[model samples]
Target chain A: MKLYNYFRSSASYRVRIALALKGLDYDYLPVHLVKGEQSAAAYASVSTSHLVPTLLDGDAAISQSMAIIEYLDETHPQPALLPADALGRARVRAIAQDIACEIHPLNNLRVLRYLTHDLKLSEDDKNRWYRHWVESGLEAVERQLAAQPGRFCHGDAPTLADCCLVPQIFNAQRFDCRTSHVPNVMRVFEACMALDAFSQTQPSACPDAA
Target chain B: MKLYNYFRSSASYRVRIALALKGLDYDYLPVHLVKGEQSAAAYASVSTSHLVPTLLDGDAAISQSMAIIEYLDETHPQPALLPADALGRARVRAIAQDIACEIHPLNNLRVLRYLTHDLKLSEDDKNRWYRHWVESGLEAVERQLAAQPGRFCHGDAPTLADCCLVPQIFNAQRFDCRTSHVPNVMRVFEACMALDAFSQTQPSACPDAA
Candidate 1:
């Protein structure tokens, strides 16, 4: 497997964690988003969206971190990313999407560039924009986990929800967002980091980390 | 099944189309997002994220439109929302997430309202924000579909990609985003809208359209 990855990208970080959790070995081919390498012709040919963490498994090159994680889980089902039952799977997916859909999209590099360059917002305002979405979004995730507080986002074991949460929290902390409100989320983040899978695949540990 | 839905919510609209496609009977319980009904205590009790399109089936309440749609498809499994092959499923999911995670989240009502009220941007600026994401995002989807020009997003049948795309295009048109570049997406949207499942469950046809 070959993963087109960026060290700091939340989406790329997600797939990295998933691969580590599954104990799968993959080639880490970095596409530096900050350096605009993702927009280059070679990377563009591989990923139509020109996004990082595009996993190439044999004939298939998959984009979207959640989809790639699901693909890995389906193909190699040792430590499943999703739960066994349909309802459990739905809950895990919901939590994952809660962060992936709501928080990460708005604060991505492209969006921030648009805010500063296109919308003409100040750097401080852009940082504020970043924090605003992350704080509110994670608070919602905190509520989602309030009823089912466990070692991970779903149960005792880590699932897709945890994969997404850890990366978003990593990004949240990078932006100096207020995460005190999301105690449950923080607890889960701490638990996830204790495991070698998450700790080893973090942004700082990545080959592309500056 | 009961869907805690809002008429114009793009997320809610995706589930409605999925339910209709499966010939499933679900009560449309409206949660007026514009009226701040989703944030109310009662709705929050049911939906932790306080988002519209929370699907309640028996004792389980599923949030996240993509998750709900997947749950419905998994439990029903007649007209499959995902493909049979792992690679194909990955492709379909990538396309769905292309819209769900990237395009829809940025243009969500909360984000737009934040742009106007909190960020103090003018309405025209807000619309530009909306159009910028939509146009660029749809063009990416167009490139995705260009390689595989079937009747639908994946193949001849309507998968989850079509379910997500149609609603997104509906919202894009509502905001007057440029659509001429994304002919494949528009073509798929037109093909999808012609179907009874997509046509009958649209925003205009919903009970809470006002």
Candidate 2:
């Protein structure tokens, strides 16, 4: 398997964490988003969406980090990323989507560029936009965690939610988003970071990290 | 099952189509997003993220439309939303996320509000932001669909991708995004809209739709 991804992309970070958790080996093919390498014609064949963290398994190429993660879990069943039961899977997926859909999309590099360049927002305003989504989105995750009350996002084991939470928290801290209010979320982040899968595959640990 | 959702919400409409496709009955408990009902204390208890398209099944309150749809699919196996094979499922999910994560999140109400209200962009600038994501995002979907030509987004059956695609197309048309660029996507949209599951559960057909 060859994973085409960027170092700092939260979505790429997610697939990295999932791969590490499953103890899978893959060649890391870095696509630099800042340099606009993702827009090149060569990268477009790998990913129609021109997004990072596309997993190429033999002849098959899977885009979308969540879908890639799910594909990994489905193919490699042991140490499941989702829960065994349907309801449990729903809870974990809900939490994952809470971050993947609600927060990270708004604060991604392209959106920030659009804010600063197209909309003519100042650097301060751009940072403010970044912080706004992260802070409020984490608060919601905090509420969900408080309700569940586990060592990880779902249970004793780190599931898909943890895979998503850890990366978003990393991005949050990178932008200096307010984390004080969401103690439960922060606690989970700490627990996740303690794991080798998360710590070793984080953005900075990637080959292309600036 | 009771679905606490808003009419015209792409996420909500996605779940509605999923339920309708499965031939399952769900109570449509409308949460008017435009009326600020999603931010209420009552809603916060139901959805930690305070987002629409939260499905309440017995005691379990599942948030996130993708999660809800997956949960529904899990419990009701016939007329499955995902493909039988792992690789096939990955393809369907990638198409779904191409819209859900990439396009729909940007054009959603709160983000648009943040653009016009917080960033103070003119109406035209806000619409430009909306069209930019939709047009570009749909073009990506078009490329994916062209690669995997079928009667629907996946095969002859309307999988999760079609559920996501139809609502997004509705929103694109509502906002007058450039639909002509993506003929394959529009072709699938036409194919999906022909189905009762897609047409009957659409935004305009909903009880709360204005």
Candidate 3:
């Protein structure tokens, strides 16, 4: 298996954590987002959107970190990323999407670039935009996490929600977003980081880390 | 079952199509987004993020349109929203997320409001922002669709991809985004709209349609 990723990408970090949790080994291939390597012909062939963290398993190339994680869970089926029950699965997915869909999408490198370059916003304004979405989005996650009190995001086991949460928190801290209010979210982030699976696969641990 | 939805919300439309596809009856409780009704305390009690398309089934209140659709597919299970096979499911989900994550979130009302009010982009610039993301994202969707030429998004039958595609195209049309480049996506949109599930649940057909 081969994973095309960038060190700082939250979505790429997600797939890395899932891979580590499942104890699966893969070739770590970096697609540098900052250097515009993702748009180069080489990377674009693998990912239509020119995004990082496209996983190649034999003939199949899966884009979208959530989809790749789901594919991993289905094929491997151990240390399941999703819960067994239907509603449990929905809650976990909702939490994951809460981050993946709501928070991360708004603050991704491309969107941030658009804020500064295309929209011509000042650096301070750009940072303000980033912190606003990340802070508010995490507050929602904190509320949801409060509802389902657990060692991890859903249960004692780290599911997809935790995989997503850790990266977003990493991003939140990077942007200096205020997260002191969301204690439940911070607790889960801490718990997930204690495990080697999450810690060893984080941005700073990646081969491409600056 | 009860669905807290907004008439013109693409996410809400996705859930409405899923409910129609599954032939499940749901009470359509309108949450007027443009009017700022989604942020009201009453809606916030049901959804922390205050986003529309919150599905209330028994005691479970699921937010996020994709999660709600997946829940419906799981509990009901008659017309499966996801494909049976793992790879197929991944493909379907990737397609759905391509639109739900990439295109819609950036073009949603709140994001547009932020662009205009906070960033102070001109109205024309705001429309350009909307059209830019929608067109480019649809081009990516078109590439994925072209790779796997199905009558619908995945195969002959309507799956989660189609559920996401129709609503997104509806949004694109609303914003006057260019669709000529993506013939496959437009074809799929038309095919899905021909079905009652997509047609009847569209914004204009909704009881709360303005």
Distance (Å) between predicted and true CA of A86, model 2?
A: 0.6
Off by over 4 Å in 2: none
| lDDT string, candidate 3, A38-98, tens digits | 9999998888878888999998889999999999999999989999999999999999999
Candidate 2 lDDT over A1-210, as tens digits, reads 999999999899999999999999999999999999999999987888888989999999999999999999999988899999999999999899999988998889898898888888899989988999999889889999999799999999999899999989889888898999999998989999899999999988999988
Instruction: Give the least accurate 10-residue stretch of model 1 chain A, judged by summed lDDT.
Output: A51-60
User: Model 1, residue A9: displacement in angstroms?
Assistant: 0.6
Native contacts present in candidate 1, fraction: 0.88
Candidate 2: chain B TM-score equals 0.98
Instruction: Identify the candidate with maximal lDDT.
Output: 1
The candidate maximizing DockQ is 1
Model 2 has a DockQ score of 0.87
True contacts kept of each: 0.88, 0.81, 0.72
What is the DockQ (computed on Cα atoms) for candidate 1? 0.90
**Deviation (Å) of B18 in candidate 2:** 0.7
Compute each candidate's TM-score over C-alphas.
0.99, 0.99, 0.98
**Could you tell me which residue pairs clash in candidate 1?**
none
lDDT tens digits by residue: candidate 2, B31-85: 9898899999888878888899889999989989888888998999889999999
